[model samples]
Target: MGKLPAADWTRREGLRQLTAALGAENLRWVGGAVRDTLLALPVKDIDGATPLLPDAVMERCRQAGIRIVPTGLEHGTLTAVLPEGPVEITSLRRDVATDGRRATVAFATKWQEDASRRDFTINALYAHPETLEISDYFGGLEDLDARRVRFIGDPHERIREDHLRILRYYRFQSRFGADLDEAAEEACAALAHTLKGLSRERIAMELLNLLGLPDPSATIARMRERGVLQVILPEAQACHVEALKRLIAAESTSGIAPNAIRRLAALLPPAPEVADSVAARLRLSRTQRGQLNCAASRVAQDAQNPRALAYTEGMDGAIDRLLLQGAELSALDGWQVPEFPLRGGTIVGRGVIAGPQVAAIMRAVERCWVAEGFPGPDRIEALLEEQLVQVLRDPSA
Candidate 1:
């Protein structure tokens, strides 16, 4: 057993009232909230499990004048929106059947059964909200202290229940697991093919989170060894691992927050068509697809001045393109990119009639300004004048 958090869990009035309404003994804080609290980590989404079914929980919430949303009701879960925050409550359950994607669960009254059906030991622990007492049926606290991510019961059986657990397993390992548990790793490698059965949306989300983890190089290396990476991202090359490593190092040294799509670009083959194929395969978001395509398209083109690239594209896009080119990270050190000073109106003011010519002259002058390292406003005006003289001299120049 593990000691509960030093901070009193019952201090919040809503939690106190909700506990009384649902019957404190019948409900205990469960899953990530409890796990995070015990580990002294930042807790989000205070979730709990109850012996009472979903409808009963809803009825109790209504009677208590608490706002209730029947979210995940089919899975025996509901949301109780309180002033402090929304707390997700679910009925204790056991898997009735599963199809490697969704599970049909039967509500259970025993805590042990609920704990047994979960994916990993660290996620199965429970804590009494009022008593601040801890419960451990699967030795989750020990695994948490050890930072070992072990699947509950048999790894193969757990993964067979939901193939998405294969990805989830790696995610947890990257964030929490001190080192890959041998049994879990072997099972994931053996069942890597099952990942294809999962939905593209789920695969995309899991991969994004995995890539966002600080220094996921080791986990990704293991994923490649287990053939998991090929199943999800066949377009990726093993040699790109070095590029990913450099990106991670750059991010750490520069204090830049993690960008999953940027890191994904580093792992992928540097080709625009490859990005298109991957974007389609993963069903990436419109914004994500655009970023991937832009980074891939610029891979072959050298960005001599990252500040100029940053001005043209956003800072994140510039960093992604530069990292792909293996450019010096120091180029991003005092990032200051001035906007091009020559707009259509500025060109029209130069006595050039505002029409296709104005637009063309603006484009031509802007190109020259960028090529000249984006000079100050006065210099930009001089360049614009020079382009105007050339255009007037030959109208076709």
Candidate 2:
């Protein structure tokens, strides 16, 4: 209800030009930016809503010589490219129909109708671009002030409109809500089975975002208690809440930001094969899948050979495993993983036969080296000779 700290980009020439062309009076800043600002949090993306339809918004941008992207034109959204970043300006809209997964919406001239259709009250708040005076028709400001994230209308009807709202509810609660709303929780639980109707990518994204919060352990535990977690991730039973508490504290003490895959990995069953199944079920990206599987695979090996784990899985994967196991993050400070010193040439130089024998001897020596904490290259020649001699004597050895 008062002036918010303005981002420098809001005053940039490109945004000013776009705002002037669109008629500043017709544009009402909306969504996350307004909610974040009102909560005294840093704003990232800026969004605005207008009564003008998509065509008029596009025409105004064209007239101003601004680049307009019809990012979601059918849904009445256009992104105006600015020097600072893209600001999405969507026309006011109301849901015409929804089937618990997708919505058919129609453009509207009334802000109240637009606000009424949003999933949560906190997300429905809007503000004046210049004055920063909030526009809250749905008690969003009151809910935000109380840190209570609630559905805009009836919880059951809202979830019925979009099953994805169940995940969205948990995501919002992880970040903004002090505690779960019992009605919203019951509605989400009752409709948890409908999560199967949503796409894997959408579910994966919301889960990742929820886990990426500063401390999502409690929120995730609650989701598990409410039977929502099992519906979305049937393979995942418990979140290892105690381990996750230590992991979160380690991240804070070490100034490491929360990582989604690592947090997800912490909650999963501690087996590489189980991680693989979970990744495939959630349709995680290749990199995320690899990191999670690598961490899971190395959890047991980390105790005796953290340096080797770091070498095999990379430093991040190794660290994630270590932290999740309640190890002090200081263990990784100044860690320089020593590389295996022997190569094929080194094996060949020892008079070992060139074919598979050389490869076999090299691998054996590397294993010994890893076991020995990767001693200096100066000592590798001796170790290689010892291994090669044993191989030659046994042949099958």
Candidate 3:
């Protein structure tokens, strides 16, 4: 019986346009939008559920001159791009069959059947587009008020339908639940093996989403205890929990925002090969894999100056290493890595000779420049001369 978002929801000019196009009564706000609104949380995605078929909804929008994309027509979803935002309106559906990765769904004639198909109770609440009345078919409102995350029907059955829900269960539990739903946890734990069937991309995305949460240490530890983490990411063993916890605390103390990739690195064993292997298995992007490799290696922390490490790697990579090492980060404040004023051509022009010797001399001078705390061009010029003399005196030395 909870009231949905009224003022803010009304302000969405896009939703208003969709209301005019789709009829106020035909579409209702559903899923995370309603749940977050009831909890006084910010709603980024405003989706709706309707009993109308996909073609019918598409025709209505076309007649109303609204832009609609059949984002997933086969699954009964159409996206209406409004001035306020893109609202997804999907026909109410019931699961016909599921294979733990995806579901074969059929349009449902009743909201009850659609609500029954949702994974969790908190996500099943629907709000009238005009009246803003909440409809909870499965005690969703009560569970939401109690700060609980529970599966709609049977936990095992729900996990069996989509194995990715196993990770989502922990994520929502951390974000909204006061205590773990015992039945849901046991079901997820028992079906943890099924998670292997999910696409690597989906698993990586879910794990990153969980790591993206502020201080998901306890939930991650719970996942570890339930054997879920080992099933998905065995690289992160029991001992790495404390490592991740330390990194989270260090990030807070250092005034750096939580970063999912760096946090993922914290749970690793500080080996580039391991990070490379894991990143490949998870199908992370090349840049993300490179960053993970850099963080897993101890080369960055071996430098005495943070700026030195920043110069060698990058600001992001240096910060990752500092947070992982739990070291003071004040030295990097208001700091910009200075451009190496002396280019290779500049080195060659300075009588170092154009060859591998020039490159080696350039490297030596660059090291000296960095060691000298990234001095200005004048110092670089002097260092260039100093290295030239040294290299000239001992071409072998």
In order of listing, the candidates' clash counts read 0, 0, 0
lDDT of 2 at 361: 81
Pick by TM-score: 1 or 2, better one: 1
Assess the local accuracy of residue 266 in candidate 2 as a C-alpha lDDT between 0 and 100.
75
**Model 1 steric clash pairs:** none
lDDT of 2 by residue, 368-396 (tens): 77777778877787787788779878987
Which lDDT tens digits does candidate 1 get at residues 108-202? Answer: 99999999999999998888877778899988888988999999999999999999999999999998989669999999999999999999999
**TM-score pick, better of 2 and 3:** 3
Whole-model lDDT values for every prediction: 0.86, 0.83, 0.88
TM-scores of the models, in the order given: 0.95, 0.93, 0.96
Off by over 4 Å in 1: 8-10, 300-303, 329-331
Error of 2 at 322 (Å): 1.7
- Across 218-256, the per-residue lDDT of candidate 3 in tens digits comes to 999999999999999998987788889999999988878
The RMSD of every model to the true structure, in order and in angstroms, is 1.7, 2.1, 1.5
In angstroms, the error of model 3 at 373 is 1.2
Q: How many backbone collisions does model 3 have?
A: 0
